[model samples]
Target: MLLISAAPAAAQDTGLNGMSRDQWLPTTVASDAPLPDDATLDTDDCRYDAELPSAFDADALRTSETAAVITVERPGPGGEGMDTCGTVAADGVDLPERLSLGSYVLYDVDSGEVLAAKDPYGLYRPASVIKILLVMIALDDLDMDELVPVTAEMANVDGSKVGVGPDGKYTARQLLQGLVMNSGNDAALALAGALGGTDTTVDRMQELANSLGAVATTVTTVNGLDTPDVQTTAYDLAQIYRAAFQREDVRTLLSTETATFPGYGEYPEFQIASDNGMLYDYPGALGGKTGFTDNARHTFAAAAQRDGRTLGVVMLNSTIAAGRLWSQAESVLDAGFDATSDTSVGTLTGGSTGEDAGPDAASAASAAPTESSLSSSTTPLVIAGLGVVTVLLAGAWRLSRRRS
Candidate 1:
């Protein structure tokens, strides 16, 4: 017979550690991006058709412009190293020795192993990193070739934008590239409106985030310019990137260095450059997203491939000056590479750093069950099952007595 303890009293839903959830959940996709004009709402809708199918079939729930979902038939070259589930890596691993960051996390693309993470799950403002989610989700919902009209709201969106205005139009592809390559807050909002507008799009994002196990995270905006409530952790940001990386289209967008969108009238077609400085500085750098605000400081997430391994890293709420995030991430990349002495990221566990409780506590909670809990259930059950039935019966009797 099994015994059940009274469920622990529900603690208030606290932020990861003691950080306030409010610090994490901002209201607008871009807190600083200017609001769209209300007068042009009906005639000049900025929203894209996210639910359209590949065929533009009205009967389909998604739009035809969305990229067709492709299943990864097999793990990439090295398996996605997800092996860092049970414990953290040792400190001595060859991570760049000098780097200061408030929070950081790294994961192998193929094997899914979290090579290293610092304050991985601590909640912080994502700033523009949130746009990656908006673009990915919109791509899944809408058709890539479908034309989406730009509107005044999206054109004039504040913060960093591709500068493509609302009067012009673009296919889903151009907008997505603009969104990722330029870290366009306007592109994020326009996509949100196209997908279904701010409120509905955000709700859907929350749903997707939960399905992907991005706990301790909340999204209030598509652009992540900052809102009172929009927040996420480095761990959750990695989770979002992991999910996006699984899609070829999303990967293509992130890996791209430059994008061109033709202009209307005297507005010369623009060639916006990528915001990920490391892409220019580091050779193996694939691509990344950048974000910042007084409230958030500097935040960045990037992925790179070298010597047969791909590493994704995220830094959040760093107190350092601007541009330091990339340097810190570069260090993280070095540390991860050093951690794996083996060539093949070595079996998801990524060379298995032998530290006892090494990973950030939150990642450990999400990746696997604790050893103590497992030991308590396993050894006792085995002992009760093997002890000639007398002791097993006694244990059951004891449990019954306690319940009475």
Candidate 2:
């Protein structure tokens, strides 16, 4: 018989000194280190035999069969953190800046390098910005050509609407027009109900966002109507914006300044004009979503391309007196493209617009939000709590008599 010695189970308790055996020494019995406080650890932070999920799995809840997964690291110190956001915006003062308030981000489509960002991870009500995720979920699950009959609930949508009255059936394409061009809340509800044959599309939105590493965000309504749970961080919104913008349909809808969707009776073929001001003034300005609620304030996302370069911009809960988000996005986009004109970091070499460098260049930026600089009304209280932690830590260190 072969001699066998049974291994001990892992320790779960912390010692008197406030360190577990696993904590006092790195748990070498397992190959992986404990997950940081920021992450949701599986297997008790041990390297289990099974594979563990990543901190953020952008590809997990994809709605499309062919959707590819992309992951961008969170912003932090020594990590790809918020400092990156501040530096990029600060670099481009010479350009005609447009953003008035809130967080913003821009990145290279090929290099995955953030060209410019401001307050990327600041949390704010996304308003209709949440529609980006809803639209993606619909695209992922249903075909673009599929028709969804407008329901009474969809028709009764409160905020910005495309005016699809009860039982006025629309093809998925038409609904998408309402969603992208008009930022129609009614279109959002219709899309959500159509996605799963029910009104719970907000849950699907949350699942997709969670998969994309937007840990602090949640969605309670398809239209971003005022609800306690309907909120997202700047980083989360950027990620969703990036995902939606990847589709060809989304791109077309965004760039259009005026659209003539077939209208209802006696409406005389109503014509819709885009609310985004940058589309008219800014070069290569692809339009995006705009939103506002009592809780969310002003929010917007815009994508622009020039000389084979593309950038996405988002702003949330900006100073109300500062003006609209489209103008802000234009300013940020100008700064980003302007920066490319300079030779500071990795600059794009000569490449004509006709030649495609393949899909790699187009998918370059991360969806992660920048570090939050804006303080909430409750932030001061949180700071006071931290001060208490510092005092406690100091006292504990003195009691232990450990002096470095």
Candidate 3:
């Protein structure tokens, strides 16, 4: 019996042994960076660590090398304040310890082993990487060939746009391409409309998040624009990407270098190339999403295959102050690949980390996504054939023992 529980909106825990609730979910931290236009939103206040230690040299690694002081807006490599304070690392593995990143998680996608991480659970605004989730549902439920007309509302969405307007009709696939290739808020809005409006779309996104074991994420926007309540962790992002990348279609769409998007109204058809720099600059790049908002700073999710191994990296609350987002991501990826030791800080777990919805919480989470396009891991958690068996689970998700 595949007995799963209902996941609530709140996260279960951040995995840190000691800290105040506000440290993980601070309500009063003000932004040192300028807010987006006139919008009101939550800020991390440049708080990168939760009293944790990093893998890099504590003495040599400073946010700035020569400057007397570094600010969050322009934090330098090994910036003092920007360290994630994460302690997770592969035993005796060397890392690109100089990269300036707030928090990141590097993991083996094929094996689900978290090779290394820095403040992996640090919470920050998920800028556009949330689009990966939006497209996941669109790809699952909406027909790619279906034609969707652009609305002016979609065209006028506040952030980045892939140029959808009222005058043109686009296939679902085209809108999705714009969403992925251009980080188009317009495409996101259009796709949400096609999937039964913003409310339904956000609901489905949250459901998928809960189903994916992404306890640290809470969805509030179709595009990853920051809202006070909208947030995610690097760890949760890795989980999100793991589930999303399993779809062969999502992989092909993200890997696309350039795609032609139809122009609506007065705009002419234009080409939208992959905005993620890693796709062009890094070898074995599997393609991923990039996002930025004044508050979010920078967030990235991408993976690559090298030496017969596939690895994914998720960087959150990052800034160009240290190194470029992709550059830091590349460095972390390299560090993860450098580990010859089998030691892992943590391993990705099956989804369904929540209170018992009815019963059988363990049984429900044991089963991975069953979609034909989605592949399940053969990782010990046996994938039972379709059947109807009622399982009585004894432990709740929080009470159950699980890998990080």
Candidate 4:
């Protein structure tokens, strides 16, 4: 059964009577503009053309230009009866009603059982969380000790950077640290250049994700920056994180709270701090990635171990506030840990059919958004639609654990 704590008087005054203090704050983007006309909504590549879901109000989603058409398909038999598309289990663990998130998944690290999730297959901008795929691809293709020279293009990348200049030179290992620890866009560019170029690196990353059963992930940018075509689902992200966690090097880097990178050429030495607060605030935090863009609000993926159980959690399109994101993730992990082994509401397929797989394995994938005519002007509309659906169904699903 669901349990809700009584909100303080102040919370009620703020329209947060049954929510956490953090819930009082709005999402990173909050606007009340009118929904765009149906004629203006792009649907050329949308798989589903029927009436929009009842829970979502077209007017609510149209308020922001970020809205675009989002299609979530039910998983096939191989999906272990889990609704990859946003279906909450009738008897899953109780989740915090106050937690604000667009799409999220909590899974058992060892068993691959989905403990609780909302809009697991709903497509949303990944922000820098996509870097996990890049890290994995880089580790597989390049030697950790290989020195990579930074080029003018690499150093010119926009967004959060590790200050790697055009004259800087560092080993793949160093750049990997900066990529994960600081969400360094420069590190990503350098690594991408080392891997051949952005196109080649992104292609390989996509191939790897498909082979791993992350069918809902599409890589357009090496650093997980917001792109109209780049997208991922919380379900796919959890799969990616679980796969990355298997690598000792990845685990070590993610678990690291702080590290020092020596200077190269004219660049000075620098200390990099992890953006993932769970490493310091939450016990057994295995480290994770953080992502954000104007198009993609706060996004995060992390893992933690307790009582011999390792749990992985992913939250996408959340508030930019770190406290809110970490707190929400911690709550999911707590529920996952408290849940019994049989409490699984679903399972993450990891994009495989339990047989030999290759790049084409995901050609028939159902969860990932298909390439469409969605342009930057209409991206916000899709995001707005997804956000509305998530809000509508967030409270509809029961979180009670099933009793044998």
Candidate 5:
């Protein structure tokens, strides 16, 4: 369990620890340590029986169909008593009750604290959330205003699209807006081509992931289309998004609710609206990404600020409900904001041994909201099955339309 330090006398007396305004923040966890018994660090479905030979095997990941099932060592242990991964201390913030999610992490951007988490290191499909990485790499290498010619290959992508035609010409900025605001796979392909081909773009994304110490992440597709080998952990997702959030352009593009794409050549003018629901509903929502695939399920990454503190949340393999992701993210952020000054949870560790352990490992242990309490509830399972079915049916409908 995370440790909660009692507020100062004035705060205790007034029942208001003005943590929102105070500049003196607690020290972030700096080393690997065992987490409290209640922390949700492991799950039967996501753990590996033995440590991996390497943090990541890019060659194996690219060639193997069963590679997604292989789990790598994460910073923290699975739960209270497990010692496979070291433990860390954390304030016992109650997770939302009965929230059905596969893996999640909640992180404080400013304090570098993991407020709460569940299977934070577990690998799951990132879906469109992977586009965050694509956008990051693009911003680093490509000019935002440079016009990219939409090729036939880009226009033919199967998932969410912004309708850029084969002959369409769009600026990198417009394509980015489409990629993020509209969750456009076509935009992703276009951007990838602009940075070279899909192969080169994915290579750069993998390099970026490795450099960030996101060793568990493997990129098989630039747009996060459900590929057999593509996978990423919630911890990695948080890290990727945090890095992207630091850039003014990426932040602006993500927070944008609407954009107008002027028709170029053969492409017709069209207006696109953001698919991320949190921007409209959650106050202080900076930006977020949402994704789904037949295999990836529902994935969401979002951040919000309150009382001068900003928090980021990542949910992977979540259930499909109209607003569940937003509500869950809001709940986590609310709990983080409500935490007292003395709330010290276990630190997220860098898995590197000896001297190789750098700030990345210590600061990278991601967090996510867990069930405040566990109970034998059959309803969530049923709902999850239904959600999968809905997704499959939606995919079938899309396939049918394409065939027609």
Candidate 6:
């Protein structure tokens, strides 16, 4: 839903495509003592067992919270998008490099166990993939049958469009389908209007981000367009994606290859093919979202099930300089599926130690109201009054298209 706590960006450290060495890893909070700045934190004695290095340690993270492996050293200089995933593992199993450029994560959706990651908590601009979050909030708040009148402003919105003219109107269900299947900004606009304007919509989205423990995510636009403050992390994306996939309706939306969207006014109904390629190309691809911007490059979050294991992956600041963004994810998933889910680098929900998550006491979950108390003080009026549902959401890749 938004970005903050500016990262250190030095010239030599900036990436070929704009990623920088600073990596957006926040280091401290008000209360706890700063953890020792070390390249790797050994988790052999923690709740999960894995050896991965996060450039920085957070005071807010408990020992178990640190179990979520955030980064690994880049094996070598990988171009903006060169096949950073590399080749077969030592055992000849196809998997991603221990260190790949940019930020990406692979995890078991059912258990929220992180399998593999590179900069999993590195905050970066999310772009269009944020709509997946918007839908999660929308599904719970908006009445599916409610018709939202379109506006010329919506049709004229910059970026991608599902072509809804001022004279055309759509049910919340229809607009959501367009938003997911086509990565339509116009649909997001109309939906935002239905939700009571962008400001209110984003506030709700942020609240949802808080509930799901996506602390790094900050929603600036309901449509997931590029904005200076938009941000999210690979780790948080997995959390949001897992929550969204829990709903059967969302599973269908993510998997649907194409759908008929109503045309407004003089426009005729049109077919909107899914902008995400993984659904068609990857065997177990259930559904996911894609995003892009010159700054964001390529950001993706999707889920697939193999051998009954439902796994989700989130990649940020990815690019064609490597390979098709989807293929990069495939390599990550390939490595993930081959690994045992029993042991994790970290978890999606709370710490495995069954204790507090540490110093960052201001996480949205604590800063904001959750499903357990929608009627409480911090809950949004629209959401609270509905006595509604809950969702976790995420996505993006720009196909002349595409946030929370």
Q: Would you estimate the TM-scores of all the predictions? A: 0.62, 0.61, 0.68, 0.69, 0.68, 0.65
Ten residues in sequence with the least summed lDDT for candidate 6: 350-359
Off by over 4 Å in 1: 1-92, 319-323, 340-404
**Distance from true location, Cα of 188 in model 4, Å:** 0.5
* lDDT by residue for model 6 (292-382), tens: 6545656788888899889888877554333556766787787778874355555666221111121232342233222332212212233
After aligning candidate 3 to the native by TM-score, how far in Å is the CA of 139 from where it should be? 0.6
> Which portions of model 2 show Cα errors greater than 4 Å?
1-99, 197-199, 265-268, 340-404
lDDT of 6: 0.58
Top TM-score hit: 4
lDDT of 2 by residue, 1-404 (tens): 00001112364555333544233222122213332221111122222111112211121122346322332234331234343334243344344432335455565544434555554543445667777767666544555556776778777766677778765657666677777667777777777777764356767777767654464566767777655334565656655566556555456656655544555556545545455657656777767877765345467888878888877767765432333457556766667777734322222121211111112223311211111211221122243355555445435533442121
Superposed Cα deviation of residue 18, candidate 3 (Å): 28
Error of 3 at 49 (Å): 8.2
Per-candidate local distance difference test: 0.55, 0.52, 0.62, 0.62, 0.59, 0.58
Please provide, for model 1 over 124-201, each residue's C-alpha lDDT reduced to its tens digit, 9 standing for 90 to 100: 667777777676566556665667777887777667677667677776767777787677777777777777788888
Q: Model 3: clashing residue pairs?
A: 3-364, 62-78, 62-79, 63-78, 63-79, 63-80, 86-119
- Candidate 5: give its CA RMSD in angstroms: 17.7
lDDT by residue (tens digit), candidate 5, 344-383: 4533332222111223333322211012111112112232
How well does candidate 3 match the true structure in TM-score terms?
Answer: 0.68
TM-score of model 5 (CA atoms): 0.68
TM-score of 6: 0.65
* Model 4 Cα lDDT, one tens digit per residue, 254-349: 765555566767667855556666765688888888776544556888998998888899987565322347667998788777764466777766
In lDDT terms, how accurate is model 3? 0.62
Q: Is candidate 1 or candidate 4 better by TM-score?
A: 4
**Which run of 10 residues does model 3 get worst, by summed lDDT?**
386-395
- Candidate 1, residue 120: CA error in Å? 1.7
